[model samples]
Target: MKMASFSSYYGSLFLLSLFSSFITIALGGTFNTDFDNLFGEERVDIKDDGNSMTLTMDEYSGSGIVSKNEYLYGRFDMKIKLVPGNSAGTVTAYYLSSIGSQHDEIDIEFLGNLTGDPYLLSTNVYADGIGGREVQFYLWFDPTEDYHTYSIDWNPDRIIILVDNIPIRVMLNRQSIGVPFPTKRPMRVYTTLWNGDSWATRWGEVKLDLSNAPFVAGFKNFNANACIAKQGTSCKGFNGGKNKGLDIESKRKLQKILSKWVVYDYCADLRRYAHDGLPYECRKENLLQFE
Candidate 1:
């Protein structure tokens, strides 16, 4: 009887410890402020309140790449619900950069009016603004119909983009010169709605396209690592303009590689394509630059 009692006590303690270990493993167990849900810099509510004014389309101060002050990398996880609207516009959950070089922009755009079939998810990094491509995806169903966790783990060697804890896309952030140029920069977490007339919605009898000017959106859980490497600068420089420092031949080669995308149209397509892909193309384009 004594032996049985001792065994039971020890078993219980062991079980508790095991469970705690699992929890810690799940959370990465480090004291991370990026996961904080507190108000202010941590929890930025998108809705208009009595005190705080609503955010605008301009580069957001903290959320969007308001100039060069905001850039980042690391694991970005967002818990958000899409707002019900005309179902034709785009709501920016976050936008890192718009007009820049080196496929630097990272965007989380929500296309509401896509045939009401699936929600389009774009985790894209366009190079030189017009010359980059975006890896596109279509969710299992209407993400706006429910709340889902969207995330991207940007490591020095690669990037893993996940939707609802399911790894959807992965990219190898490697360069050909025997160097790895991981995406390390200040990124903005934007949540706004936009028009998607050229894209979104394929089978609707009455198409609800976003031909209008603006749209609305909401976001929860916006975070980044803001890691910047010294060598990464030269590689991500203004390799966009013609006759730039990056050999003209190299620039032409880039244009040919970038030709797969129809500029804005294809960028939207990648954003609206099924979840089976997205970051793969962006990563490919990014990788191509290095090659």
Candidate 2:
């Protein structure tokens, strides 16, 4: 028993070392309280459903949104359990924002749900990098029957994406843009379970299985610690920024809720951040101008 206890102790110490050269807690907790401001309590969640939700240009009201005003530099982490089915599209959960002409996005998308031992988990980014660009990586995991924590750490100069404390990809602050690096605005957080039908593939096929349409996914336990940019981070931000979901709402109610969204103007802060594709609809009643 003593030997077993000793092994556990040392194993934990090894993990704490992995977080930072300055950290010493030993095996950082999976999703702790320190990551709250960005994600909030019970931030990400998805529920299994027999309903089919498709968000077109007009009807778009799905998913929850968060802000990055709390902290300018810190980590954003979320733990999720995926919904299953052949119709299941790419599952996305990440933090990003667009204010002014600058845009930044990061994604952890499980592209396919083919029955198998290993599902394909991919990461993509866009920044002032090589092409101001699109870079991707593949991760194989048992997504059909397990929950995993998808995390990202953001410092002033760089951003790091992690899986179980394992750093998967990094984006540099000053990328290779012809001009200055692109992203400079404070971003918002968005988590979604979308069905990417236009380019969705199931066994080398792009067609979706309508019989099993509307697969469910859940996002819960978010940790967001945002600070101002004076401090720096070691991870990189990526491409893939947009909103996806189904809109099943009446016009009057849509206007009621969408008003909160328009209350804060992106025109001054951001040129554009997702405005078209959502599950909720907007009308004259939902329109409000901000000073």
Candidate 3:
């Protein structure tokens, strides 16, 4: 894959935003494999005439999918039904990442738990290969029972993770605080289900039960509105300009979720950052201001 330069990424975003002024783009639709152009077909099971895809994991192998086109910045959304029952050691990961050693990435990893325990939603961001910022939360609803919409809204200013349209977490651009933001590289959307027994459950306490092997995860309703940079030019139909920061209601929703369901936060993990205290962006004042 050819790596996109910082100037090209930002330039495409600017052009896409400008193009949106004269064109009205539709939103909220199904993703067709023919149009989306996905790779890693052999790694996943496709159904519904390619409208839906499933990833399965067993003792022998796991499955995954990746987008063929790279996107600069946009709102990426998908509906996923996670593995049910005692799913310890299983991890369903959906993320976007740039290629190379110093790549930038945004992640949404679902850590499986015992039947009655809630799934842990682990979120992290990496820029220029420096990423230890991990925040974990427990969903209010049973994730394995039904499909839920998970979305990532990434722009030049910030990144927001939403569940069913409600904001759950927000990571602002903290470049001034020495935090590297992902603005230079283009990333492709990817999803996979694999065994993560070593550190996936209770710090590896729960091991994978192969009796429950072939655990499956369903994915559909793939929706993305963002700037697509190809060959140093902005692709047409890139309509993500309208996506913006959180509103007052969204902030309230995020506050409610954090207060009730957030299990772990990098901002509060003093021990993990004992050597450097907390990152400047994770300071109490900065965190409170964002909240």
- Name the candidate that leads on TM-score: 3
Name the regions of candidate 3 deviating beyond 4 angstroms: 1-43, 234-241, 285-288
TM-score-wise, the better of 2 and 3 is 3
So what's the TM-score on candidate 2? 0.50
TM-score for candidate 3, residues paired by index: 0.85
Across residues 121-215, which tens digit of lDDT does each residue of candidate 1 receive? 66654433432344556565566556577775654445555667555444444355433243444443444443343554442333443343233
Best by lDDT: 3
Comparison by lDDT, 2 against 3, better one: 3
Q: Provide the overall lDDT of each model, using Cα atoms, as 2-decimal numbers.
A: 0.44, 0.43, 0.81
TM-score, cand. 1? 0.48
Sorting all predicted structures by lDDT, with the top scorer first, yields 3, 1, 2
| Model 1 regions lying over 4 Å from their true place | 1-69, 91-93, 98-103, 127-132, 177-185, 200-216, 225-291
Which of 1 and 3 is the better model by lDDT? 3
Task: Please give, for residues 1-291, the per-residue lDDT of candidate 3 as tens digits.
Answer: 235687788889999787766444334444444234243345577778666888888778777777756787788998999999999989999899998999999999999998898899999999999898888999988998899999988877778898999988888788876789988788888888988999999999999999987798999888877666566465333433444566788888988998998899888898898997888887766663553
Q: For model 2, where is the 10-residue window of minimal lDDT? A: 50-59
